[model samples]
Target: MIPLRALLYRRGTPVMTLLIITVNVLCFLFEMAQPFYLRESFIARYALIPDQPHALTFISSMFLHGSLLHILGNMWFLWVFGSHIEDAMGPAKFLLFYLISGIASAFVQFIVYFGSPIPTIGASGAIAGVMGAFLVLYPRVRVVTLIFVVIFVTTVDIPAAFMLIYWFAIQLLSGLGSLASISNAQGIAWFAHVGGFLAGILLIRLFREKRARYQYR
Candidate 1:
């Protein structure tokens, strides 16, 4: 199911979400401009390779993308769920939380595939965290999702919490299956999604309290 938008609205402008989307798009454009060799060089330097000793790559790799679809998919989720999350946490805190989630995601993925030599890159993990925050902040919010089964395309209104929980479950199942099979897929860091999602759930209390305080003022 592809989420088109959420029914719930925030009280304030979502400046942080717009800025993040712009940055991700700009980064994708930069990646597109580089030559094949240069692109590989950039990914090698920035993307989080499990064996790499440098810690900065964990943060840098989140902004990197392997393909247009990869970046677009990540940005789509960020745009769909990030606005409400930013509204809840406010700009500064939202940005900090995003980076922290991405870092945590990278750490978990590294641990999951410590023996593997694949490079993990993309903002999906951070965006998944944002979705998790949204699930906690607006569990009853309605998500407009498009489900395409065979030739029939139907749009359904689903609760944000249900959609997010289902998504997390899929990621967890896929990650476990991959590990069991010892498969080396080029993309899709399921463990990163799992990690970021768990972190977001753990951090929901801080966000909720802050929002409540702001609402009282």
Candidate 2:
């Protein structure tokens, strides 16, 4: 299911969410504007190389995208689920949550891959954390999702818990499959998604405010 938006009411402006999205978009544009050789150099320096991991790449890599479609997809997910998460946690805490989740995801991927040289880039892991927190904060909330089945296309309002759980299941299964595969081709960091999600689930309570002030729509 492709989640279009969350049905729950939002409280304050999602300033941090918008700021993060803006940063990602600007970074992608800057990356694309570089000449081929320079672009390669930029990615090589910023993108997290699991083998020769840098102190900064764990955070830097989250803002880099491999393609236009990649950035669009990640930003869409962030807008849908991240707004509410930021509303719940407020701006400052939400920012910290996002960074922590991204770093946690990088660590998980590094542990699994060990000395692999593949560069992992994108905001999927951090956004997965936001989705996880949404599941905990608003499980009963409905998410308007676009579903395609063969020749049929439709929209369905699924509970956040169900949708997020389904997503997590896919990530976990894909992660395991990647481990079993013998191919050396670069692939999605499925384990990073899993790690970020689990981290969000575990850390949401710590970051969430003691009082929820948002009004239900």
Candidate 3:
């Protein structure tokens, strides 16, 4: 199921979410504009490689994308789920949550593949954190998802709680499978997704405001 949008709305502007999307898009455009080797070098410097881990890459790599499809997919989920999370936590706390969750994701990947030299790039981990927070803030909220089966296509509004749990399940199962498998064919950081999501679930309460003023107001 492809999520079209969340059926929930917030009163304030989701400035942080928009800022994040803009940054990711701009970074992708920068990556595209560079020459082949130059881009590779740039990604090499910023992308998080588990073996040669750096403090900055943990955050820098969140804004980088390997391809157009990659950026679009990550940004779409960020736009869909991030706004509500930012709304719930406010911009400052939201940004903190994103960075910490992303860092947690990088750490998870690093620990999982301790000696691997492969560089991991993308916003999937941080976005997964937003998804987790979205569930926490709006569990009963409905997500308008597009479902397509063969020639049949339709949209359905599924509860946020269920949809997010399902998503986490996929990430966890994939993570476990990655652990068991000898080959990492997809090169996807399933552990990062799981880590970010779990971090969000654990951190939302700490970041969320005690007396949030914008609940269905």
Candidate 4:
């Protein structure tokens, strides 16, 4: 199912969400400009490799993409779900939360595939984190999803919580399946999505606690 947008409305503007989309688009354009061999080399160097603990790659890899579809898919989800989360947390906190979730997601994936030589890249993990936060903060919000079965295309309204939980379950199941396979060649970082979603949930709880204390002051 492809999520088009959410029905939730925020009181303020979503500047951070727009900025993130712009950055991802610009990064994808840069990737497209490079020659084939150079682009591959760029992805290998910047994308997170399990064995390489290069500090900068963790941040850089999140902005890089393997293909047009990969970046577009991630950006689509971010644009749909990230705005409400950013509005709730404010731009500064939202940006920090996003980067932290991405970093945490990469860390967990690296731990899982410590000996493997595959390269992990893209912003899906971080976008999954945004979905997690939205699930908690706006459970009643409705999402417009495109469902294509056979030749029929239908648009359905689903609760944010249900949509996110289903997405999380798919990632978890895929990750588990990858673990069982002798060769981890799924070409997707399911574990990163799992980790990022969990990080976002935990961070939201922490933020709520702080907000509560501030309100009581």
Candidate 5:
């Protein structure tokens, strides 16, 4: 099932969430504004490549996306979940958590791929970390999702635990398949998603403020 949104109430401003989205959009626009070859060169230079990983790319690459749909999906997930996370964790730490998660995600993907030359870009990895934090912070929350399979299509509300677990499983299986194929260029960096998620699960505590951990209402 494809998650639509979490069925929960959120108050206060999600300023950081909007800011991040704006920054991503601006970055994409900047990339697009350049000449074709310059754009290509820019992306290649900033994107995280496993064979020759650059320290800065670990963070820069998260803001880069290969296509429109890529950024849309990542931003959608971020909008759907990031607000509450930012509200719960507080905006400052939430931002820090996000950057750290992105770096960790790239690092993990680099380790898994080891020597692949394909450049990994996009915000999904960091978004996955937000998802991991969501799952841990609000596992009981329900998410309205679209269930689509072949000719079947429906919408339903599923518990966050189930949805996240399913999502993680898909990433793990796809990552394993990618490994077996020894190809990280099939489009999706599954392990990046996995690593970011795992980082969220483990690192969220350090980022979470002293406020009540469970703020669902």
Candidate 6:
């Protein structure tokens, strides 16, 4: 299932969420503007390479996406779940939560894939954190989702808890499966998703403010 939007209403403008999306988009645009040869170098420089890890790449990697589909999916997930998280935590706290989640995610992936050469790039791990927080805060909220079943296609209003738990399960299972494989050519950072989600679940309470009135849609 693919989430189209959360059914919950917002308490205030999700200023930080929008700003983050803008930054990611701008970064992608800049990435595309580089010459083909230079682009490879640019991505490698900012991406988190577990074999040659850099201090800044943990943060920089979140804004770099490998392709159009990548950024679109990551940004869409962020918009669907992140706005409400930002509202619950406020702008400043939300920013910190996002960065912490991203860094945590990167660390987990680095540990798991130590000495691997593949570059990890994208906002997925950080966005997974937002989804995890949403599950904790609004499990009952319905997510309007796009579902594809065989040849048939449809939309469903899935409970946040169910949707998120299912997503997490997939990541956990995938991560475990990757460990048994010998190739270091894996594309997705499954462990990063898992770690970010767990971090979000653990950290949300610390960053979240007093309960706010739910603006249900």
Task: Quote each prediction's TM-score.
Answer: 0.93, 0.96, 0.94, 0.92, 0.94, 0.97
Better of 5 and 6 by TM-score: 6
* Model 6 accuracy (lDDT, Cα): 0.92
Off by over 4 Å in 2: 182-185, 213-215
- Could you tell which candidate, 2 or 3, scores higher by TM-score? 2
lDDT by residue (tens digit), candidate 2, 1-217: 7899888888878999999999999999999999987888799899888789898999999999999999999999999999999988899999999999999988898888888878889999899899889888888888999999999999999988899999999999989888876246457889889999999999999999998544554
Query: Candidate 4 regions off by >4 Å?
Result: 208-217
Q: Report backbone clashes per prediction.
A: 0, 0, 0, 0, 0, 0
lDDT values for all models: 0.83, 0.90, 0.86, 0.83, 0.88, 0.92
Looking at model 3, the pairs that clash are none
Model 5 alpha-carbon drift over 4 Å, by segment: 184-186, 213-217
- lDDT (Cα, 0-100) at 119 in candidate 6: 91
- Give the lDDT of residue 48 in candidate 1: 90
Top lDDT model: 6
Query: Order of candidates by TM-score, top first?
Result: 6, 2, 3, 5, 1, 4
Off by over 4 Å in 6: none
Candidate 3 at residue 72, lDDT? 89
Instruction: TM-score winner between 4 and 5, please give it.
Output: 5
Considering only N, C-alpha and C atoms within 3 Å, which residue pairs clash in candidate 2?
Answer: none
Q: Candidate 5: TM-score?
A: 0.94
Clashing pairs in 6: none
Per-residue error at 25 for model 2, in Å?
0.3
TM-score of 4: 0.92
- Best-to-worst lDDT order: 6, 2, 5, 3, 4, 1
Looking at model 5, which ten-residue stretch has the lowest summed lDDT?
Answer: 208-217
